[model samples]
Target chain A: MRGRARDGDEQRFLDITGEIGPELLRYFQRRIGSDAPDLVAEVMVTVWRKRALLPLEHEHARMWCFGIARNLLRNYSRGEQRRSELSRALRATVSVTDVELDSEEAVAIRDLIYQLGPDLAEVVTLTHWEGFSLAEIARLQGVPAATVRGRYRRARLALLAALSTDVAPTLL
Target chain B: MTQDKDHPAGTDRELGALLARGARPTTEATTEVRDQLAEMAAAIVSTNQARSRRRAGLISVIVAPILVLGVAGTAYAVTNIDWSQLWHNTPEWAEWAQDPDATVHYALPGGGTCELRLGEVVYSPDPNRPADVAADPRAEQAARDFLRTADLLTVADVDAMITAMRDKDENWAQADDGTAVPFGYGTDNYNADVEYNMAVKQAIQVAVTDHVESMGIPSTGLGFQSQEQCTGADQ
Candidate 1:
């Protein structure tokens, strides 16, 4: 019986990882840049430890994993002074500018998104980049859907204004 | 990049497209990440399986009989007594025991196991003290000291510590006598249990102080009760 339960847990973990692994990798890559793999491993370990609490529903499980990842990211940021040697090596080998952003426009847009502050930037990223609904983002973030919606709206306006300014100089 | 067909309404279509393009993963990178994920998942599964095996062995030896005794005790009480009297006679401490703040199980160095049931502001050590401790005074003091200083943050932490100890020695808590003690109490006998609990708690503190020169955690500060504290009037 215990073996069966263990098997079920392993299968569920693999299933979730298969579905959301790429997205999570991208998330960390975009946010923390080069240390994505180490953080991904940490998040996977947390997911395994808390596997019993994961919701049965697929979308809810995704959100729950993201919630864990968000907390892990917060802890990582807090104790960032103790970054691993591997992360530093990886950062040295691969520049975020070279690997992540394909074009100058995309790089500029990313910079603009970061300028909106972390909270608003996260809302914008989840909505546009990840294609999560405002309600789903709220669930993942432990916030109201209205709040996410408002932040996304504000982020869009900010991005549009920044883009317009960049284009204005060219037009003149 | 292909637009997300189910993109939410009111989002700027151009911005979403641009962000999606930026976020898109290369096939090679995605493959590498998936491989790494598979390896990590395997490691996690292996660790969990090892822990589960150790827990299963420990539970079969120690916990199974206690559970059976517990169930039998409840069953016998229910069948033998008038339901109303049983309900009426149940002390408030019984309810507190039902939802203890912490339950710690430890082994006696010589032989046998015991459980320390801690309430929010009280504690009850299982009546069945380890046989090894019963025979030797110094060993009993050492057991008491261990229990007093056992700092547990969560129930999971308690389980981990128990598992770790069990792994070191399978018969760490094996009792010489294989008899199970039934845990039940009527209203008249409830005070005796509370008194015994307080006495054991006090013994633990005294034992802890006598043994250690300088205590690190100050004997858990469990806010254990005195005889006066355990009363029907207080409840």
Candidate 2:
């Protein structure tokens, strides 16, 4: 009987792995680049260890994984170089499209987004890049949805203002 | 575009498109890595399960005897058992027991000491030994029996068993003087406990011996060697 329960837990954990494993990998990749795979494995092991605490709702479960990934990322960020160096490192390994990395417009826009400060930049990246809604980002960030929305507004206006002066002709 | 709660309007569709380009499309592990991850998960689950089983077994072994004794109106002794002496090596026992890990030792009903690490034997006195090999296989088996029937047995469990034995002993002494009529127990109850006490002690002796000597094949049933018998030697 205990064996059956354990088998069930193992299967459920694997199912969770299949569902969010990819997104978790990308979440790490976006932040830490090559270390993402190792971190993903670590997160899966941790999820299994703390499987009892996993939320039952599907969205919450997914967010639960992202939450773990986010915390791990924070720990990883400590004692590391700046995010730009990580971006450059990730960029080297990945093949990019003409607009993604090759184009001058893309580079200028990326730079402007980086200059938006970590809080604003994160809200924009989470919204645009990861495709999370403001509410979901709010949950992941453990802040109010309105706070995320405000940050998003601030980030967009800053990027728009910067684009208008320097890169507007090329980008617009 | 219509403004909605989820997506704010006029957030520059062009800018959104540009930012979206940087998003890495769904990272996937190779077939090899996925297989490895599954294997890792299995190992972790199996390891945890084994630990759980060992702990559960330990608890049952320790609790069952106490529960049985609780029924015999001998429950008062439950709180009196020195549980630490059963599970942990005391400084006094550490000097002669040889292994600091050994929490307690029992003298096999016949001969030899059964050194135990919490109801499990770590060392056993060997009757078959050439005086060179310190551990006796039968002694270990005796310990196993002692553990099994004795109920990972708390001192209370031993006390109950001893009480039964001593009650009979007192009756026998009185019977010798032709005075006392073994009160509260008929001949059967005393006989059962006496036989049980020996069977448990012998079984533990056999199990510990078989276990330590053979290292394979476990003996069935629980047995306990006489604690009083060994306590005398240790003190």
Candidate 3:
């Protein structure tokens, strides 16, 4: 009986990891860049440990994993900034640019998105980049679907306004 | 470099396309990374299962003697033995023996084991007097000492202890809704885990309220409490 149970868990785990593992890598990469793989590995182990809590529906499961990835990214960002500051003081000047992880185009657009503030940028990123609908983003972000919709609308208008200015030529 | 398929027409389409191109992952998780992730997860799950089994075995080793001693103590209780002489000869302070309620035995995070018996009035041993002569009432001090050593305990440690306890229960499958139980079982285990977690947490709260209130030391109320008299080579 235990043998069959173990087999079932192994299969469930495989199904979950196969579905979300790559997407989580992409999710973290968009936010954290070079540290993404290690964080993806951390998220995988967390997903495995918390497999029972995973939503049965595929889309909802993706949202659940995204929620975990977002939380981890927040913690990493907070701690990483402090650590990097301390390290910078002690170490010699080094570039530390991760060419493989951060593309020039992505970084440029990311800077532009950040101009919209965190809530707006989050709605835009989740909607456009991660391919979550407003309703799904609401569930992940713990807000109403209408709220997410409003943020996305505001973001679009803001980005368009920016684009119509001096930056329009470069973006186009 | 990215396909523009998601957004509707006009400026929305252009903005969405740009965002998609910009925020897209620079590197996808390759086949090798995925395989390595699976292997790492498998190893973690397997190690936890093995540890659970070891803990289950350890519980039996701990519980079997307690069960035998319970029976022996019951017989001794009824026999009307010499109270003073027996108390003197016992050599060790066994509060759980005297007052059995609210005792929890758990492993320390670093190493060794602790048995905590709460709300029991402890008496300083007197060879000339009867066992029930007087209650020294040092349970607060014992609880305080317990808190000192248990500073390292965390919620994860508590959950791990609960998992260990659950693993030892042969009737756990039948105890919950009858389904083929996995190592990490579904909703039933989750509910049980939450309930057990709450009970242990409440036990700590009760211990704090009972003992720490008088010390006037505001209880930060972290981790489990233990009896210093209960631990060590004397046990």
Two-chain DockQ for each candidate model: 0.16, 0.09, 0.19
Better of 1 and 3 by DockQ: 3
Kindly give the number of clashing pairs for every candidate.
Answer: 1, 20, 0
Checking candidate 3 for backbone clashes, the offending pairs are none
Q: What is the TM-score of chain B alone in each candidate?
A: 0.26, 0.21, 0.26
Best model number under TM-score = 3
Model 3 chain B: weakest 10-residue lDDT segment is B63-72
Question: Per-residue lDDT tens digits of candidate 2, residues B1-235?
Answer: 1345466423557768767554434444555445545554554456456535643555333212210211122211222322223222344443323432224454544343444433323432223423322332344444444344322211122333343444454322133334443322354223333333333343334323322222222222223223322322211
lDDT of 2 at A82: 24
Give stretches of model 3 more than 4 Å off. Answer: A1-7, A78-98, A101-105, A165-169, B1-11, B57-235
- Per-prediction fnat values? 0.21, 0.17, 0.31
Chain A TM-scores, candidates in order? 0.75, 0.74, 0.76
Summed over model 3, clashes come to 0
In order, what is each prediction's RMSD in angstroms?
14.5, 18.8, 16.4
lDDT of 1 by residue, A1-172 (tens): 0223656877899899767766776677766665675566556655765566667788889888888777767646532332322223333333533355456555666677778998888887877666677777778777887787788778878776776774421111
Candidate 2: lDDT over CA atoms?
Answer: 0.48
Number of the top DockQ candidate: 3
